[model samples]
Target: MYLFLSDFHFGLGTPEAQARRRQDFFACLDHYADRLEALCINGDLFDFWFEWKRVILKDHFSILCKLKGIADRGAAIHYLAGNHDFALSRFLQDEIGAQIHRDEHVFETGGRRFYLQHGDGLAPADWGYRLLKRLFRSRFNQKLYSLLHPDFALEFAHLCSRTSRNHSSRRWDVDGWAYREAARAKIHQGFDYVIYSHTHEPLLEPLGRGVYVNTGDWLKHNSYAVWEDGVMTLKYWGMPWMERSQEEGYSKRQVGTG
Candidate 1:
């Protein structure tokens, strides 16, 4: 079985809340470790992630270890860079055997073709943000930012992230229709499944002969997707074994190849 999740946005809430969320995430990972064929983290696993040479966030060590364990046991780990945590370097790839992607990735698994992305700059209305994204991702900016001390750099990044999140919370009122439309367009382009994470809304919609899935966010809903035995499911982990079938098109089947 392949598992997909996104928008953990770690370090967003109060200290106690952050700890609880981290524990919940670790539990989810542990539950699927043995059975997972691959684990795809769509995006925003962290509120801010920047890796300086020879510097690492001590708080992330435990989660990193768990990921390493899962990879060591033979599960492929794929991480797509999100707007919040896009500065991934070689640490994850070298230590935990993760495949890091900056944008969209396509691959075949379980006899199905999949299109995966972090789903940030998809809407034409987000042109301003897209232009800023380009500037932020440029080599000149990255080099200049890297020259700062880790403490200053991380603090500045965190402040910027907080401001961005505040600005974005108001716009989620759109119900993610724009993202859904983008996904539908991809379905017409011949992808059997188009999976994205960023809007933090768990959704599964049948489009033509394909499917469009949003794995949702870990901040509130704790939602995710699973693909197994040619079946795709959207599930919530707010409570153990909780299945969300309220949507018009959803199922509650247990996911596995067995």
Candidate 2:
């Protein structure tokens, strides 16, 4: 089985909320560690991640350790960069054994071809953001930003992220038809599944003979997707069925039980 999740946006809320969410996320990593053949964190695991030489956020230490443990256990870890964490550097790759992908990735598993990405700046309607994305991602801009003290830079980035989140939260229900159309195009190009996360809206829909899935956000829905036995499913970790098993939870016995 393979597990996929995204839009964690850790470090967004209050300190207490952040800690609780981190524990919940760690539980997820623990729950699937034994059964996973591969794990894909499609993006935004951090609300704003910027790495400087000899500098690491203390808050990410635990999660990084957990990820390293999972990778050591032999599950392939694929970390796709999202808009929020586009500056993701070598720490995850060098220390946690992750395969980093900056934009999109394609691979074959479970007898199917999969296209995976963080789904940012994909909609044609989001052309303004797309333009800004290019600017923000430029090496020159990144270098200029890196000149600021990490303390000030990180705090400012987080504040900007919070403001962006507040604006986006109000439009959560807006349909992402553009993304669907883009997925359909990929389906036509021979992908058996096009999986992405950014809209933070969970969806599993058939497109032609293929499928399009959005794993949603850990912040709001705690949703994720799984591929097992040639089938794919979108499930919420906080659902009744999962809640019932919270005590004796997530054993190998539960592998295909979901």
Candidate 3:
């Protein structure tokens, strides 16, 4: 089975909040550690990802360590870059052993074809936002921006992550429209599912010829989506101690067991 999650948005809130949420996230991932064929993190694993040569996230170690353990057990990991965490360098690929996707990709599994993307620039309702995405992604600009001190740049980027110039009256409407269009185009090509994350919305609906899945974000509602065998589900992480502690959230985890 394949596991799908996205828009984690790490590093935005307080350190304590981040830690609590990360634990819940890891717990969910660990639950299916032994049965997964591959773990797919669709996008925005971190709120703002700018990889400097000497920089590191002190807080992500636990989460990374958990992923490392899973990889050691043999399930491959795939990461799709999100708008909030672009300009990824070599760490995730070389060190973490993840097959990283800078954009969308297609992979076949379980007798079905699946299409995946981070759902950032694919939504056209936010054309202005897409333009900024292009400017920020320019190689020249990335190089120029890389020259700033890590402290200053990281702080600035975190600030940028805190604020977004969203123009949509209803964000989900735009996301739904964009994903539907993508699904129609891909279904003609023989895909059974189209999965994406970035709008921070968890959606699973019947499309023209397949299913469109969004794994949602961990920032607020704590949601994700998963598919096992033929069962597709979106879960909120709720644990035994959920009401009092940080385990009060949802998760999207799947093990093929196929």
Candidate 4:
């Protein structure tokens, strides 16, 4: 069984809220840890994450330990970089045995081919964001930013993340056409499922012969997805199961079993 989640944006909320959400997230992990074949974090686990040589973000320490414990229990950990948390490096890999993917991850599991991405730059009209992504991801720029004190850098990054998030919310299209189109293109290329999570809206739409899933975010929906026995289903944090439909239209029915 594979569990997929995204867009926690851990540092975006108040300290008390963040702690409560973190504990709930930890409980979900603990519940599923022993049965999971892999735990895939699709993106934006942090609001902003940048690690200096000797300074790492301590806010993520407890969750990181929980993830490491899951890894130690025999589930592979796959952390895909999201727009907000794109500064990820080797710390997760070294400490939690995580496989960090910068943009997308392609894998075969349960006899199915899955394509996973954070759904950031897939839209052609998002040229400005694409350019900014390049600038922020430049190795030289990262090196220069790393020269600043970690405390100041993190504070600035968090402020920027908040502003950017506000701006994005104002302009975000709830229909999510770009993500659906992207999934359509990938499904034509032979993937059984295309998963994404930047829009923060949960979706499970059938496109051609394959399916498209957006794992949604922990902020409002607390949604996730699971792939098991050759089928994938989107679920809420407290739901045990959501039955999948094969028809063009998808409908979710909650069940009582894992």
Candidate 5:
């Protein structure tokens, strides 16, 4: 089975809340560790992650160890860079055998082709963020930022992440249409499933012969998506994985994967 999750934003909350999120995430990993083919994190696994030479956020050590265990078990770890945690280096790959991708990743699983991306700055109207994305991704800018002390750099990035989250909360009501349209375009281009994770909203809207899936966010929904045997299901953590004959029979909080 291929398990997909996203938007963890680990450092955004109180210390206690962060601990709880980590424990929950660990439990989720443990539940599927034995059966996982590849664990795909769509984006924002951390609120802000940057690897300076010989420097990383010490708080993340435990979770990193847990992921290392999974990697040792031989399941692939695919980490797609999200807007919040895009500044990556070879640390993940070297330490845990992760495959880090800056943008989209295309692969075949269960005999279906997948188009996976972090889904940031895809809206035609989001010109400012698109430009910011370019600026943030520049090699020169990254090098300049690396000159700062790791403490100050990570602290500043966390503050920026919190501000970005607050702004996103303010605009949450109308945040997902652009993602859906983008998914539609990919579906029309012949992908069986187009998966994304920036909007923090879980959706399983059918587009012609394919499906558009947003794995949602760990912050609010604790939602994820699973692909097995050529079938995809949108699921919530700590809830029963109920299968229904009709899409409308599910709760309003649940998304239909049909």
Candidate 6:
């Protein structure tokens, strides 16, 4: 099974809430411990992250350790650096056994093709945001910003968290068209499925011969999509995996197999 999750936005909420989110997501990982083929954290796993050559945020040690633990378990883990996290140096690649992805990645499972991305740096209409992303991702800008002391860096990360993404999560309005069009653009890629995470809208749209899936944010929907066999099913987390059958009077969440 290929599991996809994103938009963790760690360190942006109350300490308890933040930790719980991380724990819940990782606990979800434990369920996949035996069967998981690939674990894809699409993006935004960290709301504010700037990794100096020698420094990783001290606060995230436990979080990173958890991920490392999963990686240590032997399932191939892939992380697509989101707009929030770009400077993925040796800290993750060398220290942890994760195959980090900055742009896109292609992999195969169950005789099906998968195209994966964070989906933040796409969307042509969002030119202004894209410009900012470029600036953040620029090598020169990264070096310049790295000059600040760790104290100031922590403070800056906190400020940005309070003023930016956390403030936006309260509003779950989604860009339905942008994702649809983006998915449509990839219909001819010979891929069976295209998956992304930035939009936070739990969706599955069948476009011609291919399928598009958005794993929705953890904040609002508490939902995620699961692909088993040749089928994809979306189910709310923290609930029974199966829902009651309408006709058979039995619990099940099995929607269908694609």
Q: Is candidate 2 or candidate 5 better by TM-score?
A: 5
- Ordered by TM-score, highest first, the candidates read 4, 5, 1, 2, 6, 3
Least accurate stretch of 10 residues (summed lDDT) in model 6? 243-252
TM-score of predicted model 4?
0.91
lDDT minimum window of 10 residues, candidate 5: 243-252
Q: What is the C-alpha lDDT profile of model 4 across 1-258, one tens digit per residue? A: 899899999988899989878987998788787789999999999989898988898878888888888999999999999889899988999988999999899998667899999987666666667777888789999999999998889878977677556444324435677888889999999999999998887778888899998888888777888877777777777654443433426742323333
Candidate 3 is scored at a TM of 0.85
Off by over 4 Å in 4: 166-173, 239-258
Checking candidate 5 for backbone clashes, the offending pairs are none
lDDT tens per residue, model 5, 1-258: 999999888888899889888888999999988899999999999888888888878878887888899999999999999988898898999998999999999998667889999987776666667667788789999999899998788877877776555444325324677787888899899898899988887776677777888888888778888887667788777765632111333222544442
Encode model 3's per-residue lDDT on 1-258: one tens digit a residue: 788888777887888888888988888887788788889899888877777787766657777777788888899999888887777888888777888899987898777788998877666666767777887789999888889987788888866665442432247444467767876788778888888776676666666657667777787656665677665666556622211111222232322211
TM-score of every model versus the real structure: 0.90, 0.88, 0.85, 0.91, 0.91, 0.86
lDDT of 1 by residue, 83-183 (tens): 88788889889989999998988999767789999888775566666776777788788889889998788889888787556544336424677777888
Kindly give the number of clashing pairs for every candidate. 0, 0, 5, 0, 0, 6
Better of 1 and 6 by TM-score: 1
lDDT of 4 at 35: 88
**Candidate 1, lDDT over the whole model:** 0.80
Better candidate by TM-score, 1 or 4 = 4
lDDT (Cα) of model 5? 0.81
Please provide, for model 6 over 152-231, each residue's C-alpha lDDT reduced to its tens digit, 9 standing for 90 to 100. 87787677545444333322226556666777777676887888777776666677777777777676555566677777
User: Which one is best on lDDT?
Assistant: 4
Model 2, range 153-250, lDDT digits (tens) per residue? 98888876765454442242247676788889999999998998898877777778888888888887787888878877777775636322112322
Better of 3 and 4 by lDDT: 4
Q: Each candidate: what lDDT? A: 0.80, 0.79, 0.73, 0.82, 0.81, 0.71
Kindly provide the TM-score of model 1 when superposed on the true structure, using C-alpha atoms. 0.90
Q: Is candidate 1 or candidate 5 better by lDDT?
A: 5
